[model samples]
Target: MPLVHIDLIEGRNDSQIKGLVEDVTNAIVKNTGAPAEHVHIVLNEMKKDRYSVSGKLKSEEDQ
Candidate 1:
């Protein structure tokens, strides 16, 4: 089994997120010889205000 964890600022639509998981699963299966059914993915969507870089919050950057 292969486990993947992805974290991103919230905003993307459901289809986009689904596509991401599909692509990631394919990549893991190709590289690790894991079955697609055995691949596990966890997505964590954080609010922009909760995620920051270089002392600037992502929500603040949009302003």
Candidate 2:
């Protein structure tokens, strides 16, 4: 079994996350010889205010 964790800023739509999970699972199956059903992917979405970079919080205004 393979456990994969991915953290990203919140806001992705369901379809995007679904596709990402599928792709990641497939990659693990191909590279680590793990069965698709044995691969696990956990996604953690963080709020913009909860994340900081260069001493600044990530926000829409930062763009």
Model 2 regions more than 4 Å off:
60-63
TM-score of each: 0.96, 0.91
Give the alpha carbon lDDT tens digit for every residue of 1-63 in model 1: 788999999999999998999999999999999999999999999999999999999999889
Off by over 4 Å in 1: none
Error of 2 at 17 (Å): 0.1
Query: Each model's C-alpha lDDT?
Result: 0.95, 0.90
Residue lDDT tens for model 2, 1-63: 799999999999999999999999988988989889999888899999999888888984568
- Scored by lDDT, model 2 comes in at 0.90
Model 2: lDDT of residue 26:
87
